[model samples]
Target: GAGVSQSPSNKVTEKGKDVELRCDPISGHTALYWYRQSLGQGLEFLIYFQGNSAPDKSGLPSDRFSAERTGGSVSTLTIQRTQQEDSAVYLCASSLGVRNSPLHFGNGTRLTVT
Candidate 1:
């Protein structure tokens, strides 16, 4: 894809259900990031993966949230035991590893918990 691509652009999961969101980063890019922006909330960093090393998963809100990147290109985020409070727009971004490089964002997967 020319830019970041996220799947299931909108997800409406019932409370207590589990949902998985996927992301495909730009080719040749070595950095991928996952962030979330909820209603009236700022962009919150969820995780970052770079070049096969361990992913920076510090931003995950809780133990129920987990993510992984395979082949250093595709990534998936899983939210277990979803709750209404988890509803938000999950955005995926990618960029070159160069210092100060800007990120290219996907349209995002808007997950709405009902």
Candidate 2:
């Protein structure tokens, strides 16, 4: 895909279950990011991967949320022990990892926890 791609556009999971959301950035993009958007809210930054350096996970809401970028391309966000409060749209974005580079975004995966 030319733009960032996210899988399982919609997910329904039970409370206490685990969920893994995937993101594939454009080929050669050095920066990938994960964000979450709750209903009627703005995007919340989650994690960031820039090249071989350690990822910035400062934005993660809790210990249950984690993410990784392998080979500087594909990334995944895992939420353990899903809760109703975790329901949101997980958005993935990518850029050149340079200053002022525009990020390309995916439609996002809408997760619902029951």
Candidate 3:
């Protein structure tokens, strides 16, 4: 893909269900980030991965939310025990992992937790 790619453009799950979102960053990009945008709210940073360094997960809301990047390219975000409040657009972005590199974003996965 020419840009960041996310799977399942839309996903609807019942409360308490588990959901997994996938992201494939642009080739050669070394920085990946996950963000969430709720209705009428700004994007909230969820996690970040840069090269082989430890991922920065400080923005994750709770233990129910987790993410992992494999081979510094593809990434997955898993949400367990979903709640209505979890309904949001989950976005993925990638960059060159350099200072001030611009981010390329995917067409986020819209998650609706019923």
- For model 3, residues 1-114, the per-residue Cα lDDT tens digits are 588999999999999999999999999999999999998989999999999999999999999999999998999999999999999999999999999999999999999998
Question: After TM-score superposition, what is the CA distance of residue 44 in candidate 2 from its true location, in Å?
Answer: 0.6
Q: What C-alpha lDDT values do all the predictions have?
A: 0.94, 0.94, 0.97
**Each prediction's TM-score against the native?**
0.96, 0.97, 0.98
Off by over 4 Å in 1: none
The order of the candidates by lDDT, greatest first, is: 3, 2, 1
What ranking of all candidate models by TM-score puts the best one first?
3, 2, 1
Q: Candidate 1: worst 10 consecutive residues by lDDT?
A: 1-10
Candidate 3 local lDDT, residue 25:
96
Which residue pairs come into collision in candidate 2? none
| Least well predicted 10-residue stretch by lDDT in candidate 3 | 1-10
Model 2: weakest 10-residue lDDT segment is 67-76
Evaluation by lDDT, superior candidate among 2 and 3: 3
The residue pairs that clash in candidate 3, if any, are none
lDDT of 2 by residue, 78-106 (tens): 99999999999999999999999999999
lDDT for 80 in candidate 1 is 100
